[model samples]
Target: MRNYSGVGNTLTLTAPYDVASGGGALIGATFGVSKLALKAGQRGPFEVTGAYDLPKDNAAVAEGVRAYWDNANKVVTATANGNTPVGVFTAARSAGAATANVRLNGSF
Candidate 1:
C-alpha cells in the first residue's frame, strides 16, 4: 500500500450551525458526526463515514437492524418508513442505553 496525500476517513466542512463534538451534522444530505465543537460557519473535521456510537431512541434495537434518524429529536430509531435512515445498528441496544453503535451507510 502506498501512502500519498495521507488524508484519513474524515472531511472538513463549514458548520451550518453551532454543533458540539460528536453531534450529528447534515451537510447537503451527507450525515456525519462533528469531530470537534464548532460554531456557525466554522470549518472543522467531520466523520462522514464509518461506525459511530450515537444517541438512539428509547425503543430497543437489535443487532444488525437498520436504524433511521429522527431529525426532530436528533436520535436514531428502529422505524424505517417516513424516517431518514442513517445506518445499521451494529450492536444491540437496550431501551436503557443512551447510544448505539451504527455503521453509517451515507447519502442514500
Candidate 2:
C-alpha cells in the first residue's frame, strides 16, 4: 500500500525604511509556514515544520514565533523534524514519536 497527504506554503511581508540620501533598504519578515504532513508510519504523528525567510537588512528576521496559542501542543506527538530545517519554524529541533496508531479502533 502507498498513500500520502500534506499542506504548506511560503508567506512573506515587507516594509521599507529610509536612510539619509536616495538609498534605503527593505525590512520586516514574519514566520512563514513551510510544510505540514499526515503520513503513515513513515515518520511520526507529525513532522513539525519550519520556515526560511529572505532578509533585506537589519530587519530582525524571524526572531520569535507569532502564535495566539502555545506552539508546543502542535508538536507534542512529533517524531522528528526532517532532514533539513525549512525556516523560522527552523526553531523546531527534533522530537520522538507519539503513541502508536491502531486502525481497527483499538489499542496498538
Candidate 3:
C-alpha cells in the first residue's frame, strides 16, 4: 500500500498483492502511533531517525514506512549495515505549539 489512513483506531492486517509459492515477500513494512516528549526550554527542534534504508521511489512502498528488518528464518541478514543512519523527520513539526512540548505525534 502506498499511503493509507485508518478510520478510527483499528488493527488490520494487509496482505501483499503478490506472493510467490516459495519466494515469499520481498519487502514488508508497518507503522504505528507513538509518543514523544520535550523538556522545558527546549530549543528549535531535534530529529528522531531510525536505522534503515529509504525507499528509492514512492511506489507501493515508501508510504508510512521505514524498512522492516526481517531476517526470515535467520537466513537473510537485515542488520549488516544496522549502524547506517537514514534521514530524519525534522519538518511538519508544530512550531512551539505545546504547553510542555510533550505529546503523542506520528502519521497513520
Candidate 4:
C-alpha cells in the first residue's frame, strides 16, 4: 500500500496539561489515554484504542453508555452538553465509584 503508515494504535500527542499515565486526553476532537506521565506541553505516546479504567464523576453509569471526556475536570462523564465524546463504558459503575472502564472507539 502506497503512503501507508503503521497501525494507529497509538499516537504522539502533546499534553495540553500535566497528565498522568492512563489519564484521558482530548486534543481538539482526538481523545486517547496517555501511555506515560507527561508534563504540560510535552509530547508522548497516547494509546488511542484500548480499554482503560479512567476517573469519572460520582454518578451511576450503565454499561454500553457513551462516555464523554470532561476536559475541564479531566474525568469521564455521561454528560454531553459541553464535553468531548471519547468512548463507551464497557462496564457498569455504581454511583460513588471513582472510575469507569471505557473502550476507546479509535475512530471517534
What's each prediction's TM-score? 0.80, 0.15, 0.16, 0.95
What lDDT does the true structure give each of the candidates?
0.82, 0.21, 0.24, 0.91
What would the per-residue lDDT of candidate 1 be over residues 1-108, giving only the tens digit for each residue? 676754556878888778899987766666778999999899999887789899888889999999787767788889887678778999898887999998888554
Poorest stretch of ten by lDDT in candidate 1:
1-10
Q: State how far residue 26 of model 1 sits from its true place (Å).
A: 2.0
Which predicted model would earn the best TM-score?
A: 4
Tens digits of per-residue lDDT, candidate 4, 11-55, equal 998988888988888876899899999999999999999899999
Clashes of each: 0, 6, 0, 0
Model 3 lDDT per residue over 72-96, tens place: 3211121224322122322222223
Task: List the candidate 3 regions with Cα displacement exceeding 4 Å.
Answer: 1-12, 19-49, 58-106
Which residue pairs show backbone clashes in model 4? none
Please list the residue runs of candidate 4 whose C-alpha ends up more than 4 Å from where it truly belongs after superposition. none
The best candidate in terms of lDDT: 4
Off by over 4 Å in 2: 1-49, 60-62, 65-108
Q: Which ten residues in a row have the lowest lDDT in candidate 3?
A: 97-106
Better of 1 and 3 by TM-score: 1
Instruction: Give per-residue lDDT, candidate 1, residue 4.
Output: 72
